[model samples]
Target: MKILLSTLAFISLAVLLGLLTGGRLSWLVRNTTALRLAWLAPLALIFQWVFFELPGMDRHDLVFAGHLLTYALILPFIWANRRMPGMPVLAAGLGLNLLVILLNGGMPVDPGLLRAIGRVGVYQDLASRGWSGNAVALTDRTLLPFLGDWLVLPEPFPARGPYSVGDLLIYAGGFWLLAGLTRRPAETEAPLKPA
Candidate 1:
């Protein structure tokens, strides 16, 4: 929930920055018209929400599979929009996140990092739950620990919590994408055709 809120906050900032830079909302809409397979992103989110939020669904493997499937569903959308401004960066972020998640079988959140961020309740929950949603408790056994959720934003800040490097990249790319929409491209690509 915190992660989602943080993402939303970043998105809001992106929109504000865009408007402040004279980027019209209509331009964003027009720019998005070139996006293909965009619905898949939302579908991926729905898939995760359904599986991760299911009551009595404590099976780790199932949740893990659902998490992977969510990525699978999103990959096509990203690929389809690869040419869009800031998309390559977003893809890089997505790739890093997917790589870490694949290696660890889920996103890992370090308890110590959580405590440092003053999210001790989350750390305690992870300790009791073994895994929460798509995040597994970070352990020494965790592969690519550096890529895990250890980056912290302490209190007295909105959207304060642990964030991965990939998360930072994702937010940055999102900001660029939204802000970039202010500038009209030289030429628009044709809509993708059935292959």
Candidate 2:
């Protein structure tokens, strides 16, 4: 839920930046449609939804495989679009997430970060029970704890949650990419020079 909210918030900001910069929504639409391997994104989301959102899926033994598969599916589309503005940042973020997930078996969650974000109950539950959904509580055994979901947006912020440094980078890249699209075509694309 927080991930979805964070994504929406970043996209909203990007759209606002686009309009403020006199960028056409039509351009965003057209450019996005032209992206290569775009279908992979929706397919990945659907894959995640099937594994995590469908009723009784939480109990399925393959939930872990589904979680890891989500990353595998997303990385390729990001790679295919690597030359796009801000895609490198997005790729770095996704890469960091994939690293931590691969190392730790899932995204690690810091109970302290959760508490700081007004999720004490959730923190306590995780602290006691040790695992929930695709996230595992950050503990001494957690490798590369620094890469875990230690970031937080506290109260009064419309969008708030336990996110990782990687997640922030992903959102920032999305914002940059969308906002960059609003620039005049000439500014976005350099004139070809004779070699």
**Best candidate according to lDDT:** 1
**How does residue 150 of candidate 1 score in lDDT?**
78
List candidate 2 segments past 4 Å from native.
Answer: 1-6, 59-61, 115-125, 183-195
* Reference-based lDDT, residue 17, model 1: 85
lDDT of 1 by residue, 59-152 (tens): 8899899989988999998888777677788889989999999998788998777767676765776889767777889998999999988776
Candidate 2 per-residue lDDT over residues 1-195, each given as its tens digit: 766776787788997888787888776766666666888888998998888667665442366689888888988888777767788898889888878978887789987777777777667867876655667789899999888888767576655767798988888887887786665545443321211
Error of 2 at 190 (Å): 9.1
**How does candidate 2 score on lDDT?**
0.76
lDDT of 2 at 97: 84
lDDT of each: 0.78, 0.76
